[model samples]
Target: MSATDDVDRSSWLSGYSDTVEALPIELQRNFTLIRQLDDSAQELMDDVASKSLCLMNQKTVLSPKERQQRLANIGSLLNEVLKRGEEKFALAKSTYDTVDRHCTKLDMDLQKYEDEQLIGPTMGRPSTGTSTAGSDKRPEKEEHKRKKRKQTRGRKKGIAPEVDEGQQQGEYLSAEDAKQHAQSAISLSNLPIDPNEPLYCYCQQVSFGEMVACDNDECEIEWFHLECVGLRTPPKGKWYCKNCAELLKIKQKK
Candidate 1:
């Protein structure tokens, strides 16, 4: 795996190892206390058992005087056992309390570290450079609206059309002839024109309807005056009206 993967895995592994290792050291101290208490209790129990056995033997088979003496000895040993057991039980309870307190402290420390590392960076604060104050602040809403407007304008206009790098070698014509030819044969598609637009006559230099229609006599479109056509230059070489340009793109696709 890559270095990043190794580092991520190691971070988690190390944290878990630290937590587990801490428990053993803590448990060791508590267990030692528990063992000491148990040893004391066992010693007391052994003393009581040994003394009681001696007393029984004396009463059953030895003289009556020896039995009385052995009875006192057994009673003393029994009292010591009971006393030792109580002391040991108290010590074991104290050890448990100490271990419990330590564990609680460790848990709290771990929780604090977790909160600081995981939650702090995301929620604490935004970076200074990422935000601005007062009227200079750019509102997110306006920024989105600006982007949308730019995209809409882009959709309306194509990028600068490609111009022919080399000059055309086709038959040359006088400016007037070029305009006349352009006017006569250019029949437009049935697309409607706005009536208020001026229509120019190719021969008479007269404008009629609000459009420049071509002179295919069968055509429904108006023609531009020859002078008007010559006066209007192509943007570089490629020339098309808004609707014609859109149509050209569709034809190119086929």
Candidate 2:
């Protein structure tokens, strides 16, 4: 087997070896000697059994002196094996007691570490203190501000703020300029004007009808007949042509 295979095989016994090493020097030596004695005793027993088997297979009857000598050798080997077995048992018991003690100590240390580092701080609740003067007044100030906002919200809609007049006049002037430009462009075209049709009326392309002008002053197209745009009656409020409505939406977005 490779060195890696040897290491892997020994890993299961690593804990046992570590426990033994932690023992006192005298106990360590005693355990080692016990293991050596056990191995030696096993070898001697195996040798004696093998020799007896060979003798029986050969059908060779032993002389009386040889028989006695063989008996003596077997008896000595048996006594040695028994002695070594007892010593090994004693050493094993001692080693087990030492390992169990070490394991117990380790468990207690782990529990102590967990209490001091993980549980102690979390279990002790922090003390509460009085709020500062500034903090104590903050809520009252916020309540007053909220009351002022509610009072403003209760005002009548008729008292709303007025729009700037200069902005309105500028819009009116721009609308008039756009209308003049559209008229000039139409005049430059060579197409003959139909006197029967209203200018800027989409309904003229489809059918003749009484047309209404868009309320938006900036719109170049002036009139629309409701029938052509799928409306049964004139719309409520200020009405706008499709082109002027699109332009108004763009301005509002800006």
The sequence of per-residue lDDT tens digits that candidate 1 reaches over residues 90-181 is 76566556656655656776676655544444455665544333223335545776556434533343222335562212123478766665
Model 2 Cα RMSD, Å?
A: 44.2
Off by over 4 Å in 2: 1-31, 54-69, 122-254
Q: Which residue pairs in candidate 2 collide? A: none
Model 2 lowest lDDT segment of ten: 164-173
Residue 21, model 2: Cα distance from true site in angstroms: 8.4
Residue 156's lDDT in candidate 2: 25
Q: List TM-scores for all candidates, in order.
A: 0.32, 0.32
Q: Model 1: what TM-score?
A: 0.32
Clashes of each: 10, 0
Over 61-80, each residue of candidate 2 has an lDDT whose tens digit, in order, gives: 88989878877877787788
Position 188, candidate 2: lDDT: 33
- CA shift at 97, candidate 1, in angstroms? 1.9
The deviation in Å at residue 32 for candidate 1 is: 4.5
